[model samples]
Target: MGDAPTQQVPGLGDVVGYLDSPTAVCGQRLSVHLSSTVGPTRVRLRALRIGDYQGRGSRLVWQSGAVTARQQHEVEPAGPDRVITERWPVATTIAVDVSWPPGMYLIEIAPLAGGQPSFIPLVVRTSGAHSPYLVVASDLTWLAYNRYGGRSLYFGPGSNHTQSVANRSYVASTDRPVDASGQRTVFKMTLPLVRFLARHGISYDITTDSSLDATPAQLVGQTTVLIDGHSEYWTKRMYDAAVQARDGGTNFAFLGANEIYWQGRIERDARERPTALTVYRQAGLDRLARADPATTTVQWRHAPLLRDPAALVGVGMSVVGVHGAYVVNTAPAWLLAGTNLHKGSVLDLAFGNEVDAQEPPGPHSPANLQVILHGTAMAAGRTKPSLVTAAYYNAPSGAGVFAAGTTYWLCELDSTCPGGPTPRATSGALEQITLNLLRAFAVPRAGRLHPSAATPYESPAWLAKRLPVGGAATGEGQ
Candidate 1:
């Protein structure tokens, strides 16, 4: 085969790299590793405060001097898992100080001659942040889907078009380039919210899923912890930490669906640095049922660990490959107080991709669950349709939890979605609802002040009969 074409933008030559660590504390240091075909490269680092600043999408926080670019050795995937370890030489080292606020940042590297730049996502964390809200970036999920060296946790290395777990990796390394620098999830889910928060003057701190797994104590004393985007993977420590925080009256808002579904853990190196995410998928066979069943990499709701996510998030992912809109069930409600939306108002294209629904009033569900939005989506190859629900509940500890029941919620904040542009009116209503929830949850023990009203549709028997669509919304047992 001919020489591989350089990964470049516009006029720039190829240059790809990853940080020695995905995250760094404000006072710590981080190294940048790069392999470039470009003669000389310049590093332009920016902390993304407001994602879309006049359509630029970033604010220049920091920049580094031009560095010598060296063409490093081409390392391919090794071992049965096809883990690509990029042990490139450090081109530059950065000292993260007080100027670097704790938030999501992007490091852009390109040729000094000017070209399309490559990006690396970094989360600057703080140990003693007492912000009323905490936003946990779904870094683990981004790393899981990272297909840098032609392989990822979901697809094997090759030109094979089919994406199957059978040919996928059981482990994904953090020391390699993540496809597109994980901009897809970061921009779609986290950045929009960050922009919204900054615009609304909401003070919130940001951290990574790994940080939550490593030092979950940071979650303590916070009023609310926001888990946004497709947070699919979770470790026992992360799960327990969230539950503990919630029980301690720290409210939570899962702004996206398909969260806390898989069980996984971060494997650290000898130096105690996170090197890879190891998840040996049980895939329904419960292959590790006998050995360390508690830590098996199966669905959290599966056997050996009958911990249903719905018990925590108010709703669990029930359907995949879903495409539809959210049909309002109850408006003039607390969340929809300032919005123009009312019962039966359809938020077009608000539900797509994956979605969650409360199964029934069982042991896995919250006791006083209130369904805010209910709709239906037809899943692939299913004779019957599945219900999508956005709900809220007040825990016995007086902590409130809101589940958006759809992964597309965050993107809708900017009127952007997979299928098409979300209607401006619909986006405005959703934004108002989000603002209401955040404002209410910013206070400690918010449920005690503004508790969820009881709903009759919490029962499976009741939900089985109601359609909850347009025209009949008021009679859906609200």
Candidate 2:
């Protein structure tokens, strides 16, 4: 309110643009400018509400002035532009700073004196300036016991012997807080990572349970990728959506183990909340045939895609267990840049440490696949093959398709084994390889920066030549 200002601080257009910016980081500061015809007696800044639009309904995420005694809120004055910079404490700022998962959110800014609130529509993204908009599809229908059947890590109260195995493993807990309001734990670990990345700058979207049918066209705004996390079961629409995204220049990261093994259908209630229905079996090949005949199968043995020939020596489909101990492997590669490992060293086990091995190429294998990491036989002896494969196939749209072999291993980047330990030699190598693949197809703004000089391993131009004609090797499941 200085010198007959031409603009008002709480003008509708100003607030609209501030909220409309495509990029906004949580810890970053936002300065709002205002003007007034005459200097008001006094001025103050406060958050009004955080809201969103879903279908035809409006939802409120937060309200203003509803602070607890322990929460703190304050306002600061900016320069003569009559700008009032509102400073919200980190903890209490959740109302203003909070990101609405992967969905759409509508934020409103209102004048304390009761003027109409300005609406800003925002899509919270994950980190990375050019990071792809990652959509995490978690199939909760088939919650594997333990981490891939070793000690029931994802199921319940239990323990593992190996340090690497235990550290990266997720044990089903009766006490651990469940995600999405105690409905599932898979979302719990995954959602936090999503939020963390979004707060840092990465853009992402999420579809869970029955929301899997959100469609590939709906995800058009996304540029780079899609993620399949520990997705044991998937509905037909979900599968189609992933396929469409991949063909449309949207790369993929399979961050879970034994993905696409089972087929699921969505059962929605009146409110549209989804409940997943699924079927599982010891023999994935048979199960796949029963579920979806069009699905392809993976080749666990003697396949050009596998990176390490030793790991698949005995294990397949399911893993019995894994030891999380560091071993010597390629370190100068780009993926290991920031990692402290040099030569023979140890790192944390990422996932599927000890698992029930099943036949190689267990089920639903895609064409033009590549194997990045191969699981080595542990002391328990590698019995069956646990194949972690990646493939590039030609979709109906004429674009190539890239599909991962194993899902769980990809998620191990920040996870620990169930034994409260470190990764063994072979598993550690797998973790590094997984990181490389994700980074390659991630947002693609810049290659991952390493503190020290690192060599880039570019994808081979003749990859198409290496792939089998007509598609992947058929009927070679182990």
Q: For residues 413-478, could you state the per-residue lDDT of candidate 2 as single tens digits?
A: 333222333345434455545555445545422212222221222222222123211111111111
So what's the TM-score on candidate 1? 0.89
Cα-based TM-score, every candidate: 0.89, 0.44
Worst 10 residues of 1 by lDDT: 469-478
Error (Å) of candidate 1 at residue 33 is 0.6
lDDT of 1: 0.74
User: Where is model 2 poorest over a 10-residue stretch in terms of lDDT?
Assistant: 1-10
Model 1 lDDT per residue over 1-478, tens place: 1111111111222777788888888778888888776545554443444444545545666777777667787677787656778788888888888877777777767557766666777888866766889999888888887767666777774445564445777788998876642445665666667767766778788888988888879888888999986798898989999999999999999999999999987888886778998777774443455777888888899877899999999998877776666777776366788787877777876766677887776788886888888877555566666778898989888999999997778877876555457788778878999999998998878888878876665442344355432111111000
In model 2, the runs with Cα more than 4 Å from the true position are: 1-131, 137-139, 142-184, 187-189, 195-200, 214-216, 219-221, 270-350, 353-368, 378-412, 415-417, 423-439, 442-478
